[model samples]
Target chain A: MKREIPLFLTAVIGAIVLAGFFVPHPYVSVPADYLQRCAVIVVAFGYALGGANLVQVNLEGILRRHPDWPYKLVLLAGMGVTLVFGLFVDRAKFQDPGTVSLWIYDHVYVPMNSTMFALLALFIASAAFRAFRVRSAEAALLAVSALVVMIGRVPLGDAVMAGVFDHPGLPEWMRHLRLEPLQQWIMDWPQNAAKRAILIGAAMGVMATGLRVILGIERSYLGGSD
Target chain B: MTISTDFGVWIAALLTLCVFSFLYKDNPLYKFAEHLFVGVSAGYYIALNYWTVVDQYLVIPLRAAFDGSQAGGPFQAQMQDYRGWLIVPAVLGVLLFTRLFTRLSWMSRWSLAVVMGVFAGLKTTGFAQGDLVAQVQASLVPLWIPGDLWGSLNAILFTVGLVTSLLFFFYSREHKGVLGGVSRVGVWFLMISFGAGYGYTVMSRISLLIGRFQFLLVDWLHVR
Candidate 1:
């Protein structure tokens, strides 16, 4: 009953929503709209369930004196404090600049998030130096293209290009050899064509997978092998 | 140079430094900041949805349905009508919590099934209309243009590139002779595009680093 009922529900609900697109009648549209709202509400609950799970896992870690027990305690305390402020405090006032919840978000969360990403800058620079070596034809092409694009996108590259073009006795055609224009040409033609092809392929794949799920041919999301 | 006087800014600056310290070496300070970030974000989202989804959409509608009272704000007019149909979703949302209990875990599947089903159906039509049809239409470009040599050349190149790239993915027949040569051209196009993507990504990461430096130098420490 458990497995069969859910599978049946999936097929029925999927068909109704799919029919609404083609039928466009109030009978189909209204039920589809209602089902969508239900889906949103259920998804929200799932997120809350995830938050609860986080608390449970960390609390267990703290209780067991795990390797990072101190950090777990800190995590739980942070969650507990934030939850209390968010729940008990007036909802309308919770978002005010002076509120504790807002303070934590702006001062703590924002900085931490930005700094984490900022660290990636250093890592990427080091990685690119090692990875962008030009040993073969494909590698040379990739490296040269990357170098041009990188230089062309930045103000420094524009300045360098302008300086070169300003040299005395330079040919008229050499004056037109600007990095930005070349970058634009590369992006607009070959890059755009390749991206479109990839998009079309991906769209086909999505439609196929969606059909499979709706028809019950794909049941991995149902959580067990059937 | 002057440091920020605001107590909150100081706390923020310290936390930012604590996270950045991981670049040098992982330590207790970095670990604390990481854990705290996760905890706070989870808690914030929980509160956000509790008010936005549950209270605003589910509870208010149910209350107005029972009492026939006008709920203020954007939903006021809808509240006046009082939808009895909303009860179904409310019940299903509650069923989602059943997963926490082992005995009732299977019941939660019903809620997940509905969500997945509706999304699958919607996505099928969405991809078909928006992506598949639109892209195919876009790919049907003119191969030749009158009185514009460069334009015609570009058009032909675009057409050739698109066809060859698509052929590269077709696995029904072995790629050899003319097919192999065309596929080789497709590989070069793909490589160039990927290289551009990688460059763009690096630029963005660097911009993020510049933003942090500006914050630290301009906002936290007064520097000209």
Candidate 2:
């Protein structure tokens, strides 16, 4: 009964929402809109549930004096402080610029997030240098293309092209062969075509997966052994 | 060379350095910063959603429905009218907490089922109309432009590349002869595209690094 009820609900709800797109009547559309809003509310609860889980797990870790308990303490402290400030002091305008919550976000959160992504710059450079060796025809083509695009998209490459093209005796053909123009051409034709192809295939895959889920053929999300 | 007087800028710089310290080695500073980031962000999101979704949508409406106050907003009016129906979702949301209890965990499946079903339905039509139909329409390019050889060549190349790439993904038959050659060409196009993508990604990451450097130098240190 448990399994059957959930599956039936999934099929029925899925069908009704999908039908809402085609059926513009107030009866269908209004309910569909309400369902979507309800989904958002449920999702918000899910996030709060996740936050609760984090606190629970970390508090347990700290109490048990597990390895790296100090970090857990820090995490719990940060969450507690932010939650207090946000829920009480700045509840009405927590998002306002001068609020304590906003202050923490702008200073601590923004820097941490940006720095984390910025680290990718150094890692990518090191990784590309190590991995971009030309071992075969395909690898060679890839390396050359990457190198060309990398250089062509940057100002240094444009400066070099400008210097060469603006020489006193430079030909018209040489002027037309600038890095930026070549990069644009490559992006416009070959890159765009490949991207479109991938997008189309991905869209097909999404449709198939959505159908499977709606039909309850994909029940992995239901959790438990099954 | 003079540091700024702003304490917040100093805090930001120190935290940025703490995160960047991971590049040198895993240390307590990085660990502290990482944990703090996750916890604070979670709290922020929880607060944001409480105000935006729970308090605004659910709590306020339920309150208005109970008090019979017409002073509340538009959503409150709707909820007051359908207050009975609104109880269903509130119950479903409360059921999600049943996951914490072992025996009652199965009840949470109803909530998950509704969420997944609604999302799957929305996404199916969204992808079909927006991505599938739209993309296919875009691929129908006029290959024979009257005056522009460059445009015509580009069109032809684009069409050929798109077809070959699609064929490459087609695993129905054995790619042994003509299909093999075409698929190989498709792979070349894909590789080139991926390379460009990687290059673009690298450029953006570098730009982010530059932004951080600018923050440190200009904002914190008052460097020109």
Candidate 3:
């Protein structure tokens, strides 16, 4: 009965959501928006559960005298310290001001994130060197396009290629002709097709899941009903 | 000003150093900073949602429902008629929490069903127009090109690339002689597209990391 009910509900709800899109009535749309808002809250709660799980697993490792126990302790300490500072620290007059959370976010988080990203410039250069071999026709096309785009982005390319200029140079022509046209073609064709395909797949998945939930075919959430 | 600016600069330096520590095999201080980040982030979201959505929209208005004077609550004064519908969602939101209780868990579906059905209905027509119809329309092009040999060949290859790639994804048919060859070519296009997409994704993530570094160096530390 428990399983059957969920499956039935999922099917019905799935159909309703699909139907609601075309129905064009406030009766359906309003309810759907409200449900979506509630889902966000529920998802937020799920994140809380995830945070709790992180603490629990890490703390357990520390208590068990695991080899990497010090790292686990560091993790727990970090979590605890941040939680304390955010929840308890005064926002208005912290000397450093802008809420303790914001202070951490702006000063600590953003810089770390940017530094990590800057490291990618090194990785990209290395990867490009490895990928630059002319093995296939497609490879040659990619190499040429990449080189043009890279050179076009810099001032040095224009200085070196100045002899080939009809007022503005080869870089300008490449940008307008090769890069712009290619970008336009991609936006016009392939991206659209892929997006539609993905949307259809996602919509189908949502319908199937909704049906399972609404029709009572899926009782995974019901915690072993007797 | 000096004190506040100095503190900001110091904290920014600490964050920068902690982040860069990852380059030198992960260590204790780095782990500590990472966890602290997650915990603080969670708390902020909780506070933001409770303040902005729940407190502002739900709880205050529900209270106003009982207050006989129909006019003077914070939200009721602002929104008026829309305030009543808050009950429906509030009830549904509460019902979601009932998943914690085993016997009454089935009620959560009422909320889920309503949400999914409505979004799908709302999005279908627009998604079809924007993502499907427009895309297929753009794919169609005139075959004749007047100017040059290279231009004509480029146009032909581009058309072939677009159509064959689309056909390669078709699950309904078995590809046999010519169709098989076209589909094989389609696979190459898909690989390049995937590779390019992967590279772009990597670039985006790295850029985000660089933004963080720049923030620390320029804004926080005031380092040129």
TM-score of chain B of each: 0.85, 0.90, 0.74
Which model is ahead, 2 or 3, in terms of TM-score? 2
Q: Candidate 3, residues A11-104: lDDT per residue as tens digits? A: 5554555555666576665544444554554444444444566777777898899987776776566556555665457432322455776666
What local lDDT does model 1 show for residue A201?
89
> When superposed on Cα atoms, how far off is each prediction in RMSD?
3.2, 2.5, 6.1
Better of 1 and 3 by DockQ: 1
Error of 1 at B112 (Å): 1.0
Model 2 residue A165 CA deviation (Å) reads 4.2
Single out the weakest 10-residue window by summed lDDT for candidate 3 chain B. B73-82
What is the per-residue lDDT of model 2 for residues A43-137, given as tens digits with 9 covering 90 to 100?
A: 88887888878988898899999999999998888888888988899978987988999998898888988899999989998998986778877
Q: Name the 10 consecutive residues with the lowest summed lDDT in model 2 chain A.
A: A170-179
- Report candidate 2's interface RMSD in Å: 1.8
Clashes of 3: 37
User: Which stretches in model 3 have alpha-carbon errors above 4 Å?
Assistant: A55-97, A116-226, B1-5, B68-126, B137-159, B202-224
**Global fold similarity of model 2 (TM-score):** 0.94
Off by over 4 Å in 1: A93-98, A131-133, A166-168, A171-176, B70-82
Model 2's alpha-carbon lDDT is 0.85
The sequence of per-residue lDDT tens digits that candidate 1 reaches over residues A60-130 is 89889999999988888878788788767747566577788888888887888888887887887789897
